[model samples]
Target: MFHPDRPGPTRTNLAIRTDPDQPSDTDPPSDPDRPSDPDPPSVVMRTDPDRPNEDLIKYGWPEDIWFHVDKLSSAHVYLRLPKGKSIEDIPPEVLVDCAQLVKNNSIQGCKMNNINVVYTPWANLKKTGDMDVGQIGFFRQKEVKVVAVEKKVNEVVNRLEKTKVERFPDLAAEKESRDREERNEKKAQLQDQKKKEKEEQRMRKEMEELKSYTALMKGENMTTNEVRTQNINQYILINN
Candidate 1:
């Protein structure tokens, strides 16, 4: 049983620990090609940083870089190596942070195992959005594994039972039917609007064509009347 009040063997707090395989803090590796400090430390960012006592973050000597249980939980772990520490010198606390986060967030009593742990250049970690007041980031080594743990299913069943008790099946069905009817009505209205617009456009075009034809006939009639008048005047002049 994982208890919040009591810290168990599985629940390790963020007290600093030493790992023999880690590099010396004084002489961390540095990259010559990069102008900025080559060995930036890895960090795990969380929405809440002031969240007292949990897996929050783990930082240690470059050689001691570590992460928590691999692939089991949502643990944000990272390493902060000295500028002089080699790429391999990420601290063991990196893994520890990752593991602690997994343990903290997982269903109580279930164990997450075989999670993956990996490392990237500190520069690779990016933060896109504004973090809430206490959030931070981390770095971990390029080593990780997937670990399996038993999960508790009782809570899930209990929730389902509660939902069944509170459900209003009849009311829900009525609402669904009403919603479907409304959608159909809206679709029919849109179709009707389109048909109306097309009919109006057709009528306008027919009206315009009729007007043009009438104007052309009137112009022809006017020209014929003028020719008749000219012939009449010429005949009278000839007869006189």
Candidate 2:
């Protein structure tokens, strides 16, 4: 259950987290070879980075790099691997950062002076049979002995995340603009209806006036019929 005092998560707020397993805001684009998509995947991070392996499996992609503390229990570190780049192409600085993320995930590593970290492409890893949500089995992976955890894994990941999120256009703003256009159209339709009603009313009044004029003429003819018939020649001569 969510706490009442806690603020709800949103795109902007969800972007913030203490763990490196969460994709970095500064992550580079995966599609460096071609023009990026106009609308790409939006930035979505799990609120809890407690179990990184599970998060990686759920949110991580085949191109992503997986990192863990060598023998100690650790959270999974997912590096957004660049497209068309081999494992050797990864920058040394970025590797050091990933090592730091792995160390941070382990309770023992954080206390020790240094810890060894292992990494492999997510594509190379597979989940064991009926394993827990966050658990995974790695057949083989590259290992690096990182003495000082200069945590930059999150930074590189952040760069890649920015690239992905930028592709998604702001839908809320678009929805508002669409709503305004609809309102304007409805208002114009209503005004046009009012104008048409007024025109119709005017036509009805004109027809009534014409009918009244005919009736008045008929009544006058009826009232004067006897006088006119009695002296038709006199009446015509007088009128002439």
By TM-score, who's the top model here? 2
lDDT of 1 at 76: 33
- Candidate 1: global Cα-lDDT? 0.40
> In model 2, where is the ten-residue run with the lowest total lDDT?
1-10
Q: lDDT for each of the candidates?
A: 0.40, 0.52
For residue 38, give model 1's deviation from the true position in Å.
73
The candidate that wins on lDDT is: 2
Residue range 83-136, candidate 2, lDDT tens digits? 455456566655554565456446666567545666677676766656655556
Q: Listing every candidate in turn, what is its Cα RMSD in Å to the true structure after a full C-alpha superposition?
A: 21.5, 17.9
Report RMSD for candidate 1: 21.5
Which tens-of-lDDT digit does each residue in 8-34 have in candidate 1? 212222222122122245323432332
What's the CA error at residue 133 for candidate 2, in Å?
3.1
The TM-scores of all predictions, comma-separated, are 0.28, 0.41
